[model samples]
Target: MQWLKVIFAGFIEIIWVTGINTANSWWSWLFVLFVIALSFYLMISACKHLPVGTVYAVFVGIGAVGTVIVDIVFFGESFNIIKISLIILLVIGIMGLKLATEEGDE
Candidate 1:
């Protein structure tokens, strides 16, 4: 459940970060703020039961990867082999960290 919160927060992070890049209207800005608050709250709640470093790392990893994909798919950012390779490497690293983390360590 805690991990789920972290995951949700990470996706929310992606949303707000994208929002910041593209938001121009008042309502869009307000939505961004709401998502930021939601993500922060989720992060804090997850931290209470998980290793902070692991939680934060995973959260940022998700946001980073998601943002890159969003840029490519929605924003028409150019895609290249190098970008995909790096993203794959990052996913491996995130998985490694997740696997390395133990419940007892929390």
Candidate 2:
């Protein structure tokens, strides 16, 4: 479904952030590029069935929060209460956006 595609695209976008950490060679670059392309393609496809503004905002918010968690967990980035609280806020915002969707928008 459209929501599935949107969620997948958003989740995979974490690769855009962490890929740089692993892109020390040409092959890595190619792989990351492929991921980027696929993510965008999925987003575009989902837009056919969902509101672009809602989908984009939710996707970016989820992706940003996901990337931050990925960095902190896997890349040894510093973790703090502020970051945690901000992530909570981001989750709430995403939920609000999703809930705000009109029945006709689905």
Kindly report which residue stretches of model 2 are placed more than 4 angstroms away from their true locations once superposed: none
lDDT comparing candidate 2 with the true structure:
0.90
User: Which candidate has the highest TM-score of all?
Assistant: 1
Overall lDDT per candidate, in order of appearance:
0.96, 0.90
lDDT of 1 at 71: 98
Query: What's the CA error at residue 90 for candidate 2, in Å?
Result: 0.7
* Candidate with maximal lDDT: 1
State every prediction's TM-score relative to the real structure. Answer: 0.96, 0.95
Query: In model 1, how many backbone clashes occur?
Result: 0
For 1-106, candidate 1 gives per-residue lDDT tens digits of 9999999999999999999999999999999999999999999999999989989999999999999999999999999999999999998998999999986976
lDDT of 2 by residue, 1-106 (tens): 8989999999889887689677998999998999999999999999998999999988898799999999898989999999999999999998999999997998
After TM-score superposition, the amount by which residue 9's alpha carbon in candidate 2 deviates from its true location, in angstroms, is 0.3
